[model samples]
Target: MGADREGGARHRPVRAVAYATCGVVLLAGCASMPDTGDLRDVESTPRQDTQVRVFAMPPREDAGPGEIVQGFLEALTSDDPNYDTARKYLSAEAARKWDPERSTTVLANGPGTAEDNQTGGREDSGNLTYTLVGSRVATVDAQQAYSPAEGPYSRKVHLSRDPKSRQWRIDALPAGVVMGKSDFQRNYMSVNKYYFASNSPAVATGQSATVADPVFVRKRVDPMTQMVRSLLDGPTNWLGPVVRSSFPTGSALQKGVSSLTPDDQNKLIVPLNDRASRAGSGKCAEMATQLLFTMQNLTPAVDSVELQGPSGKRLCELNDDQAVKRPEYLYFLDGKHQMVRIAGATSTSAVPVPGALGTGDRELRSVAVSRDEHTAAGVSIDGKSLYVTELASGASLGDPVVQSHGATTDDRLTTPSWDSHGDLWVADRDRANPRLLLLEQGAGRPVEVQTPELSGRMRIKDVRVAADGVRIALVVEKDHKQSLLVGRIERDEKAGEQPVVTVRGQRSTTPGWEEVTAMSWAGDSRLVVVGREQGGVLQMRYVQVDGSAPDGLAPAALPGVKTIAASEDDRVPLVAYSDDGIVRLPSGGQWQTVVKEGSAPVYPG
Candidate 1:
């Protein structure tokens, strides 16, 4: 009913450690033990013809190995095409070689394929050549496998001695071939085929068979015997199918099924109902949900899913299961509309209301969003405090604030804004000494800017810190008249002696720009201001640093918009707040809808 609990690797066998030295002691030890599962002996024949003949025996029958090898070399390299002429000097057994099956000549090269100057072709050679570095047992090497298209080639040969004749020869050459999984498996199984062919009759007759190559047997099949021994010696209940299923299979799917852990594969083929019957409610629900979700996505059992409230009322229906798994995150709505968290199969247990923002316990000081929705600012609640916790994860960052007497009390603290260099700036809103605090990169207290000329009779409505954090702009009521004041901060070692300058417009300013609700840097040189007048209509205006004011960019229809967020590239303004839903405005000649009002937009950083 449930998954099996045991598993084992496929056909792993015990192997003997091979030593490089082949002395009497090694041979004696190898002779005493017969390695299991090797069947390569069927292909080895001691009686096979093993002589190499030449057109003439060299003058040095006992010549040094080098001189004897040179004679064989001359025979093969004398002609443009070496095969026919080279075959003439070979012994009857070697000369009669012909592979009608195409297997032996799979990589052989033909005429005009050898690039030797004796061959009449400019193209690259495509033949593998074994150089006769003298006869006897001096050395064996290969010339490059020539290719017509490529000019260069290199090769190495496998040299071996004939066991029966006790003579040396270049018996094998390296094959530059890569086998696919099927081919490898097929060839791998052939070793077993020969083993069984040689041993089955001996086992049936109750007689011992001569051992095959000890090196090959121990290298390959002995490990499977060990694996079988381990499985048989362990607990029998769980190991049966695990051992049996660990073999190569008919197809990839079958192989994949075979390859899984015994438990997982059993879980796959076993009935889910049976497994669930024994599971506790919690475990059952978890498993069932995963299975149901997987099946719902992969199969066509259900048409759609309707999320209902506890009262049996439908909340939201999703045609796509993919959408249900990741419902849009709604951040700009209040309790009356958007549901922040949902619980259970039904959606009745929704939690978290909008506007009632969580500021990570008492750690966050202040928070503010720009009217244009392009910028947001926050600082610590107390003037003495420096860093505040991020509302989402409680991470901390240093924020600058204008120290006011009542900053520690219930007095409203201004939200600190960030500039391009990650500096924070906020105004001392409650004090008679209302000054601008410019937070910089030093280790001590913040540097303050006080301009009595800019502070008198001024009730700051909105304050904006520019991208440099060195520039401060504000909409203040000075002398009972609303005015726009732009100033630069003079940094110094002291706490509050820096001077500020008011930038004058071309007309020396008419009435000074008024009703500025929020401000942010629109570009390197421009500032966007979101504000409203007596009519309660919202207006977004862009102005240069040197200018007084400019015309509105967005229409006056958005009266309830409060906060704005900008795209990473600053190409769009997402105006969002918690009242009716969420709203996004892309910066274009005309506004177009990207995210609907009711669905929350997951802000990607």
Candidate 2:
């Protein structure tokens, strides 16, 4: 909606008060407060030029109706050049009608006999109140009761008089037709179309044409302009009034609209309903999806192994003794943690390293796993091209998709997640703060997701998908304070309301843990977090489905856990690190070191 404009419609302010009350659910981004519109007074007349009424008074205490009427006629048809001669003989009512200009013209043409009075025929049959303005003069109100086109029009005129001098004068009025307030309102409101063609020829009988007002033209063309315009136009039309009344008037929608006509009421409610429907439709539903994961290494891996979480089994391992050394490789695993496939396994220049090397960086710099555990995506540490491969066919989906941010770029990609559509959502933490980028199929530009609350002030440590593809998770760092935020991406098309997009923080159960590093979906609802304690102990924590803290949910004995993933059944989680190796922990807290390689493994969710 647009704002209210001046001169078009007048708006009156109504009394209202409001205070913000944040809810348990994310509500910080609520926009659009109520605005009130009051009725304005109307003052416009119909005729530009018209005659005035003249009343005449008599000398007697009680004058006959005919005598009073005759005096009024003589005053209206006065023939004195200066009007002084005529005014001297007028009774209080007659003097009021004697105009000097009219008298000059009448005298120039010479005064007529009594038969000339019969031409217009002045009548005074009813009792009309004559106010005494002076000792000898009194004046009665007059209505110009006749018109050339539409005869017998109603008009009210004020009369002035001098009682002592017995002088009277008729009031001057503008000439031509004029419309009243009711007429104007009826003409505007009764039409379906806001405006009709002013000068152009009309369209065909059944055709409709949009008027070409400059303001209207700008609104339809400029996306943001329309919103700003609505803001300005609200006071004049429905925008401001509806918003003020429906939202903050301390009145409910029904109650606030009760005073408006049925048509006006519908004008307000219909658009509001449409806005809510669009917001709801844009929200994601409950569903699972698979994402691809790939990482770059200073030294590439010579072997890849997959472990099945169910029954604590090893599924498959791929080993290449003399294969080409690849710079980075993205890996995908099945529900059983078996190696699905690795994409971007090509030659690189880095020297080989088998054991843990602080310099090697071999654990997949960028990775994204599909919800269904089928498709995977990976990018190198540098913001280079993205590699996506389907696990089922062991085939590359297409050529790598290049994504670069800065002028001088790194040959690496960033961590990519999946929105509901299984499209890739990645963040480049290489900048001042992590920036979000959405890559969709058949689209020329990636959707840039940057919020003022997150972009410059908060740094993104990790981006992950919830079990439900629609929910997004981010480990954001701001002011040295680390927090986990969960939110559904929502957009608000209406300018009057707040942008529906928002991110709310979750409760942290791990005490003294300043920041969270990674997250893996434990189920369709639950999520597991890897956090560093203030004492520098790497601990595993579980966050509930909702954004509540996972107090008392971390295991007491697990150590050096660099990464963690959930089992297919969600009954146990797999953890890996440089010291404790790969340990498996059941939901009941039983633990076992399943591997000693220290390869950072993600869950097969």
Candidate 3:
């Protein structure tokens, strides 16, 4: 099913405070009596399937130093909107200086506290210190960007007795909130902020090629308002170079606009400040389109978005269909090793493409059609040679554009992929001399792309370049395990010098999977991955580029999936080669057999 349709069904509104009492049970485990003075193992309480609202209690009068520290740490994981209760455990000056929004540090387990001062126990002492320690898992920056982290984490919290009340209070602490992995997952959700590809020709012509910049935001905390603010604030630091926001510079939501809710008709009206009043009709429409795409995953599904100026004048409006693209044709190789295509998601019959590669004159193992659908690149059955051919009836099979010298078929070239810029990319798995090559416009000498981050025994198993031409997803093998990673593509094009293409900032997108068998870009920032976790059965799930799962349920189970195909346009059904033969999952429908003998299914790039 299309991601949008499936997401709508999965995102229906649920009570936010369904399990209010559960918070006491979860947080009580972190606290200790004033007399014990003992350190306990810190662990995260498992999250429930439904939304949970955790309310934290304020520190009691005359609380001991250990109790104050534990109360503050437990409060960090609560749903207290402004963290007011958490601040109660801090001194007056420290409470005023603390900024919980600075950044969030996630630990493998919840933070554990240990008394650092060696002085003999004395209630008369005015000062104390405690050590907070845990293993780091990931971090969320001020921009709401999530990045996986590793290694040990250690910080200090200082406490002092209040001269007026003679109560223990935290004098100093970390800048932002700290929590365990489970609490992080429960408190924040992954959201994709839409932007236009900065380098695409479509942008110059007033058209848009949508790109997704994923970020994390607090759930049930007026998320609609947060998402709108994030969209206007622009893309994150890592993706800022390749994408551009449609909102005008200095544009922001109207002052004092704390909550944004869609109307009964599911139409959202966004009121912008005076800075956006100067935007023309065309630019306003583009801005509305960006919001429309960004709000697709929200509950009740916003059917339309309208942009309003400072004076409450409607500048432009956009509907869901107007902002989303429909799926194109589905391309694949038949049992006879011929490239064929179906019209679209609803088409029942498949026809051989009008090209030399479809005539079966030259046997092929796998094929990739260019984004424009004018040309195709195929790898031989033995996987030694790579050929490019025209999609014309009279065209002839030409000479091999590239060849591999691997000793066996399994070590030869992988399936080729095309970027939106018409460039072709493939990885030669030759153990003796492996390399990633890029062919500009699918012709001429292939250039070896630089991947300095992929050192050691890492080897590329599969490659899929995003439609934006600036990001590439690769399945790499290391130590007999397969992992999916996404990297940025930077091209240095000088008029008189050779172009140098490099892949940098590679990050793991499926760290838990032991084997990533196959994957395809299912949406702007989402991929449908087929893989298995350690000692687990193979399954298919949609994961964002940031290694976080999306909001909807996973795709229905399929057996022995060898290859999968999906389009960036979510309107298309997902096609896969499985034990049941070629099957498709239609929107709001089950997987149905498309053909009994097809392999290597793919959609136009």
Candidate 4:
């Protein structure tokens, strides 16, 4: 099958907020993206030109309404241009009104139940509705916005036979389309739009932490436009509650401009609607930061972001570095659980953490340093208690701020994690009543996290909250099967000083893989997972927050691995405990041992 120049299907973005162009236009817009699809690695399997391939044959001769419904649903998955074949399965009137691009309901691969409702109850007894039910994986909205869903879902198609032709064609149905997971990968592309943490205090300091909102866009369409519009539309429902956007409400792109083009200097030029005309310079700068961080992820990533106001006047321009997330102060505990640090990912030596915690006499089992490096939380070797110590000079250490009643020493708490909001999280893995607790300011009577998704048979093995306060990674085991899952942290909107956050929806980040013994956040939206295939040896790999692994060779195997730690920034190295003892992975090099005596090493977010 040949590849069609005309790309197929409804793809991504947030609802496009069109701006009223005040007679200002950029001629360099939408000038065709480089058509380099052929340059991609060729596939081994024979492919088909979806543009001409008939997905569903026009209902079999004199086909019944049930067949019409089935055929119509099948055609939607076919990448036919404008869904021309799908319309054939619809009545003339329905054909004119039916739109499969309104949205897409992606389902887990399986046979969807198609039931014919022919009870002969209505005035038009022959007129019927066919129901298609399945486990919905996600819903891509009319704007190409994707939102994951849980539980069950059903789709209804109304059909009536063409009396004159003695044939059936769908008459009524929802506007959106439905397809299995395989088709989704073929036509959809995933992109991340960066947004500053909604509740972070770093915003005031011009060093706000950013979070990644992953979204899917059509492969051949104006993805830069789709991504920009989606970023402006805000995060997905699951993530919206936990993040904030710099684009003020009502701000949008210039009307008729669907393409975001880069200037000769590779700086992206974003034309904004009048909604941002009144924004102060500072606000405009923040808005630019959001766009710079987001647009930099696109292919031929932009080096800078230039914002044009309603009047076409330059509001602001910012380089990618200027919009970078602040550098986190990293610290790890040495063999003695004493705070220490490595000069760089390739550095073979370690330095002591700042002040007393580095020189303290406390014997600890595990330690976690705050983002600011001002405090540290350590669990006792017995694992029954948690302690917090000031990292300042001669600062005193606090008594056990948290205690557990684990029946055995092995059923104790794991390492603690510090979020951008100064909150510490840890999991108490008591086999009987496992608990995930959030301790404010490094310690205290923990607030049992109310994430119902993590409840039930599974026991929590490890929990690490990302530097961005909105996400958490957990490794759990149930009936001997261990898996890695990530959850979005939600908090009360008005929970000002005393914030209360819970792990709302926890889903697998390393799906299908079992024996996920160790995992850590490698970046805002990436995780370094140490997983073992069923009955296979342990292998270390990287996975996205969306559960997809990075395409390429897995990192060199680090057998006999006990645990791992990674800096929140992807630029930082990934450190792990392996047969070679403490080892680190350079940017593009093999893993090299950094410390022979190190155990459970970590980079503080």
Q: What are the lDDT figures for the candidates, one per model? A: 0.30, 0.33, 0.80, 0.67
Worst 10 contiguous positions by lDDT, candidate 1 = 1-10
- Ordered by lDDT, highest first, the candidates read 3, 4, 2, 1
Say what the RMSD of model 4 is. Answer: 9.5
Residues 1-605, candidate 3: write the lDDT tens digits.
Answer: 11222434111111122222333333552265342334454566567543556667788776788788888888887777789989999999999999998899999888876776554445567887777889898898989988778899889888889888999899999899998988887878776678887754452235656777888887746678888998999998888877788788999999978778779888999999988878888788889878887777544357788888877888889876533334357888888888888886777698998868888577788889888788889999899999998888978778899999999987999989998778899999999998999998899999899999997699999999998788899999999999999988877777776578888889998876799999998877789999999899989988778776566678888888999998876667899999887899987789999999888998877
Displacement of the residue 423 alpha carbon in candidate 2, Å: 2.9
RMSD to native, candidate 3: 4.2
The digit string of per-residue lDDT tens for model 4 on 185-262 reads 555656667777775456335567678877666553455787888888888766777788878888889897857767
- Which 10-residue window in model 2 sums to the lowest lDDT? 286-295
Better of 2 and 4 by TM-score: 4
Q: Over the full model, what C-alpha lDDT does candidate 2 score relative to the true structure?
A: 0.33
Pairs in clash, predicted candidate 4: 14-230, 19-255
List where candidate 1 sits over 4 angstroms from the true fold. 1-359, 363-404, 407-411, 441-444, 479-481, 492-513, 532-538, 548-552, 565-569, 576-582, 588-605
Model 2 alpha-carbon miss at residue 151, Å: 80
Q: Tell me which of candidates 1 and 2 scores higher on lDDT.
A: 2
Local lDDT at 333 for model 3? 82
Candidate 4 least-lDDT 10 residues: 1-10
Cα lDDT tens digits for candidate 2, 251-271: 111222222111221111111
